[model samples]
Target chain A: MSTTTATSGRARRPKKPITLVGVDVYVITEDGIPKFDEYGPFKIEFISNRGTKVWPGYVSPDLMLVNWYRCRFNATRPVTDKDVDAFVGELGKKHQWSAVQKLWNYGDEAGFSKAY
Target chain B: MAKHVITMLPGEGTGPEICEAVRAVIDHTGVDITWEYEDIGLDCLKEHGTLLPEKTIKSIAKNKIAIKGPTTTPIGTGHKSANVTLRKMFDLYANVRPAKLIPVLKRPWDKIDILSFRENTEDSYAAIEHMVSDEVAQCLKVITWPGSVRIAEFAFKWAKANGRKKIQCVHKANIMKMTDGLFLEAFREVAKKYPEMESGDIIVDNCSMQLVRNPGQFDCLVLPNLYGDILSDLCAGLVGGLGFAPGANIGDNCAIFEAVHGSAPKYAGMKKVNPSAVLLSGVMMLKWLGETKAAERIEKGVDKVLAEGKHLTYDAGGTASTDEYAQAIIRAMDTL
Candidate 1:
């Protein structure tokens, strides 16, 4: 018993940290405009439809509420995927997401967040 | 030749009484076993001031096998359970409880036989609970990959050795994706190695329903600790109750056989409580020791006595005392 020490036989490596640049989600609505109700107060700059900016007030009575909206949210600091997931998940509790696109910054500084 | 040395913990309450009856039946089988008694549980608490004495643990460690009577864990006393302590000390990870139908007792169905493989030593049974707030308390449910794999391997090896045709991996993988998912995943990996045996899985809730509705369909069931604790008792109800249930805790180095039923302190010294459970546990001990002939003899004797319906304890609906019921088993052993 004295000879045995409390340690693992194998050498273990620590986990690497994750860097999250921003989070993007496509939220759908039932009866209202996506920008007014779904994308609550974040630095969401440009709303797009197949690569076209249909933002600021895209709500029109003639346009049917097909209920699909995609907005990109920028984080103040680099965050992990877990951080982005928590943000998106809390939003999901009230609003439904037809689809979610997470935009990551792998340190290339390609400026995908600045493209819009 | 020297007899096979086996450790015995007489336990508390009816544990000692029923154990004496079981010892008598084992004696009649004519197999030589030198009993090494150890004071544990309540008896040890009285003398040594601890529920599980160090000597008791050392004895079982040295002997490698033991048949124990049911020990009482005084509730709300803040002391850790002697059973849990012993299991953790030895890393006794696999808890095996067999629920076999007895012809004497009436049931919803007949010929129902099930051997449950419970992953001991983990799950909420680890007892890592904390007060989240004044109104709320929470317990951590822990699951590990190696714990799952070893129990799965143990279950499959038991199935292969015992000639069982199918094994059911019971879990709630849909809800507890991480914990039960790992459990089911390990079971699937181990099942692939046994080509001859049929392997499948069922969710815990649906598995409980299937057990009561159609218990005979299940051959061997493997599950995590919590679900196993619940479902094993449910299976026991299918074929009478705990009196007919026998349990075994299997580890790499040591194994302990025990009656899954409680030690009825109220019925202590009355000689009225049924001894079949512990006696059957002794049958399990004999088999574990490789005394297959003696094991079979005692099993048959128990069956014959129960089938005759002449000498059963009050729980089984007869007028016989605990010792008398044991004597009836012994009397029938002559034919075996």
Candidate 2:
């Protein structure tokens, strides 16, 4: 490897930026509205989806961590079809399913916030 | 080179149409075929308390090759699925589908071609379901080393044998680590043996996106049973739809070929709906039978008839009925 010339300019080596290490999901359920309480307070962990990794499930709910599916970030609330419809509709409108998948579905988006 | 038997189960929700469709296509060939039919219906729930009869499973065990139509898997616990029963009973490890551009139909895609070797026997389809509570339900997804190894091996061998260039192990390794993780681990282990072929891992969801985006880039994809079911259908959509998809369930000792389609109950007794999937499935059966010449003739006839698109079915944007399309295939065969 060739070293950068100190007189000309210092080469900026590529470095992975630090990111939010943990997140969780919780939803406030309004009275009289029943949610699809199928799976509750699901913990999402991130992992690389491009390369080879051991898998018993077929998709990544998270794409941030490595070698673990038990994520500290959790989404604990009853999800409604309206929410699903609105999310999908918004994704379609913006052509942003891929982006949305990163944040919520695959857990790759670095910018996840708690939803009420 | 040898005679084979194909047992057909056009189970509940779809009746006789698929059976007739398959029979019409194979009639074009000279190969010797023996078949059996099961007197099954939704009544199986009342009589046997099951959708799959013990006799049908025994028949599959004895002959090893059976073509079937879609069956009803009630979302409830009343009767288990016949498809799942057959998958478990035979340990039919690989579900294979071939989607090819027919050079006739105008679709959302062009020059599209895909082949899939899907795991047939295990996963959530294991029928290991239980009622958790009044508010929730659970289906246990079981993935074992042998299950993963068998399917992955099938993918590689199929890719190499079929002149395919790559194998993708589709998985969701993020959420359920141990279960999905085992599948990925087995793929990595098995991938070492087939360095001559390319291997890639696509997360199941992305596999969905990329497939719809650029289906032409894929060849010989391997997925577990359930995921394969969904992906193969998606690929079918890229080329045509389920009506053009042909499939086979193969074990070490036995095999069966059939149309990879659903029961269009609305078209029942109408002598309609495309028989192309089952007809091509018959062609695949011919290939498996070593009747490559007969298979070629059937496929060529299908190409010729479908290329015209005039005698096509409603799905193909034509008015031709099932019998009409079958006759078209037959007429194409006679000319061939």
Candidate 3:
């Protein structure tokens, strides 16, 4: 087996950042409790700046959601601990008690704070 | 008549012999084609330090059409498949493979003419992977709406153009709801526009069983990358084997016609392997270039030779060598 590097053989161009306009969140609940798994509790549909729905624009329910939150709002400033707190606070208000509480518990259990 | 310039990658191993055979047969049909030869596969890797060189890509890009022989890809290790790389780089999303039975071959079933439209890019072929832990690894199965819609539209258009009545969308949406579900949704969305044509969906596993059980039941099939890759080869088995399968990777701007088989390295210099796959691929190339008369001549000649059950290579259960088989096709064409 010849160890050759399989390159695209085409010139590389920088990828333009996709501008997110809005998001549709479908929250799944079981027995009045938010069901969370690898796919996350909510299925997110991202609407691009061009009004086209971005396929595969969903995010996992990990610390990555924080990055998605920042991008969705177009926050150019650096992320702060206060920003993370406010994001979780907004989620609690929008999705109600059980889901946000479960997310926070999972965050703690997964050591998301330390990782961040 | 205007001469057509085509990129010809004879590839490696038995590629050269079969490609020369196709060239000779095409010449006998009286089509004026200037072959722009390029190198790929292991030999090119040694010289250019890449499986696909810049010159080969340039030639194909300039000509906008290419006919290639089988290129070798290492198993389980080494570089990525040059075939997959070419398809991706050119955005050749639709891989069209037809399985039409030659009456003389006389397999288990007769009247098997099925065309498979496979999504050539995306899905697990994206090659995105990561190791989360020492014990676990993950690979993402990527399926996008645009990718799905384009391939579905291509399949329907080709079917309609070819006078095919039914088109089936093969998928496993029942299992991977979101990923495969998106693919199925796109197929349905596209099918609605073609109300005059019949359209339906089938699960991948069930589709496989149905294909072998009754191949005549399927007219055409459209599928995503992985499923298409698997099922297209299965369809090839229905008519004969890969030696009889001719494939095309088509996109909006460009198209590539190729043999859907591997370079038989063990029989590289023997000149005993069959050249039917590459020769049929040449027939496809002629049709793509609007040289219908030449295409028909080659097709008729091949059919005549096969029907005679003489002058066939070892794979076809005959004693003739590769050059002898090719010469027989040329002689048959002269009669036509």
Candidate 4:
């Protein structure tokens, strides 16, 4: 038997950390009424801001409880409750009160300060 | 010839029996292989308190090649899948499973040869799941640019090398605009590099229907983790079942060959399960090691045995035990 040490020929790529910047939340509705279903009602996009470049993050329907609209965004920087308050403030500007109520009800029911 | 050292993970249940049979048949091929035995799965969990031991990982890392039998993973509860863990730990990003018509065990499609390249790491297989509340839960599906690009590059290279004429990117991009869309985009970008190859994209649901309707239309398929996991099994069904399917998890540094089927704990020592899956996997390992002549000899040996219809195990519609079937293949190899 002959002996020869084996080595990997493939080159390794440098690992870079992807930073999560913001999140886009869209309440799916039919005829301006919020549609409660497993596939939708709330569609979320976790936007990533890698270095100075911004790219579209992964999108998924929040298929949790039909009543509760809660989603988590993993970010390189800490996401404070103040950040969520600002996000909710933006939601109030664009969406109807009834649609926005679906989000706020979570905080009301769970006795939390903000909708996350 | 330089003797190759390989990490041998004889998994669990019928894993040991099938691994033994494959080892015997591979030895018959006359390739110089020194197997470094390692423990994995439930038995290892009992002894080492983990399904995968550090020593086992070190062995595969050192050898850069491994052949494993089917390992049992606890369902719903207990530790995560040992197979998934190994793939993630080793960064075995590309999972290649080839389903071809074994002429002897004749099926509907005479020319069913579909090679599937699955993105092994990331996607939902990342297991990044959380319970938002008592009644609510979510599992994040991650798709990174680097992850997608590497897998696409790997698939295209593999297709070009293997003389595959066409390659299809299977995804649910229509519904998943960003995640699967990025996966499709990466595949298209990679396809541009290989101008000689024909490339196309299909929605995963449509691809599944097309596969069952007429499998011959597809040559090579590349998909993200979840879809690839599901569709590879479907491709296996085209020629035969999981019993005849062989899989290989390949990374830049290392590769692990295994049977796509699960370890049947119920049939552990019965010696009744078929050994073709693991045997064919061994053939793949031989080919990866550049032992082409030995690989072909083993393939021909297996084909000869199956064609004779005498020593097939229970899964293949015969009454022969696992050892009997393995012996038949070894006996057939002598003539070659």
Ten residues in a row with the worst lDDT in model 1 chain B? B128-137
lDDT of 1 at B181: 97
Give one digit per residue, the lDDT tens place, for model 4 in B75-131: 865677889877766678899999998876768775788999999876877564443
**Predicted model 1 interface RMSD:** 26.1
Question: Per-candidate DockQ versus the true complex?
Answer: 0.01, 0.01, 0.03, 0.02
Screening candidate 4 with a backbone cut-off below 3 angstroms (N, C-alpha, C), the clashing residue pairs are none
Task: Tell me each candidate's RMSD, in Å, in order.
Answer: 20.9, 16.2, 13.5, 16.4
Ranking by DockQ: 3, 4, 2, 1
Error in Å for residue B325 of model 4: 0.8
* lDDT, candidate 3, B13-42, per-residue tens: 999998998899998887888889999999
Error of 2 at A110 (Å): 42
On lDDT, the stronger of 2 and 3 is 3
Instruction: Provide the TM-score of chain B versus the true chain B for each model in turn.
Output: 0.97, 0.92, 0.98, 0.98
Residue-by-residue lDDT tens digits, candidate 1, B57-87: 7788778889899888768434667887666
The top-ranked prediction according to DockQ is: 3
Q: Considering only chain A, what is the TM-score of each predicted structure?
A: 0.57, 0.22, 0.23, 0.26
- Interface RMSD of the predictions, in order shown? 26.1, 19.3, 17.2, 18.3
Tens digits of per-residue lDDT for model 3 on A1-116? 76756674655544333222222222332232232222222333221111111223321111001001111122233444355456545555544332221111111122001000
